[model samples]
Target: MKKRLLSRLLLTSLSPFLFINTASAAEQAMIVFDASGSMWARVDGREKIVVAKDALKQVVRQWNPETQLGLMAYGHRR
Candidate 1:
C-alpha cells in the first residue's frame, strides 16, 4: 500500500512536466500517391486508383485535422 501511494505521488508530480513538452508539438505526415497508368488498371473490376482514393478518404476521415498533412501524386502526365 505504501509503495503504491508513493508511486502514485511520483506520477502525479511528473505528469505536468510530461504534458508541457507535447503541447507545442504538432504531428506531421506526408502521403504520396501513385497516379501512374498502372493505377488506372482494373483489379476485380475496380480501378486501383479508385481503390486508393477511397482508402485515403477513409483514413482522412478518422485522422485528427490538427495534424499537419501533405499530399503528392505522381505520374499524372508523361
Candidate 2:
C-alpha cells in the first residue's frame, strides 16, 4: 500500500525528466540526485536510498539512448 504509493510518487515526480524536447539540438539531460543523510531514512520498510536507486534504474532503462545524459549528486558529504 504505502510502498506502491511512495514508488508512484517518486516516479511521477521524475516523469518530467523523462519527457524533454528531443527536437532540440542539444538533446541532453541531467539528473540532480539527493544524497543527503536524510535519504538514509526508511520509507515503507525500505531505505529511501534504495527506493531512489530502483526508480533511477527504471528511468534509465526507458531513457532515450540518443540523448546525452549527465548526473550530478550533492549532499553526500556532511
What is the per-residue lDDT of model 2 for residues 7-71, given as tens digits with 9 covering 90 to 100? 77888887676556667787888787779899999986899988888888888898889888877
Checking candidate 2 for backbone clashes, the offending pairs are none
TM-score: which candidate is best?
A: 2
Clashes of 2: 0
Q: Runs in model 1 with CA error above 4 Å?
A: 1-24
Note the Cα lDDT for every prediction shown.
0.62, 0.81
Candidate 1: lDDT over CA atoms?
A: 0.62
Off-target runs (Cα >4 Å) in candidate 2 are: 17-24
Lowest lDDT sum, 10 consecutive residues, model 1, at 14-23
Backbone Cα, N, C clashes tallied per candidate: 0, 0
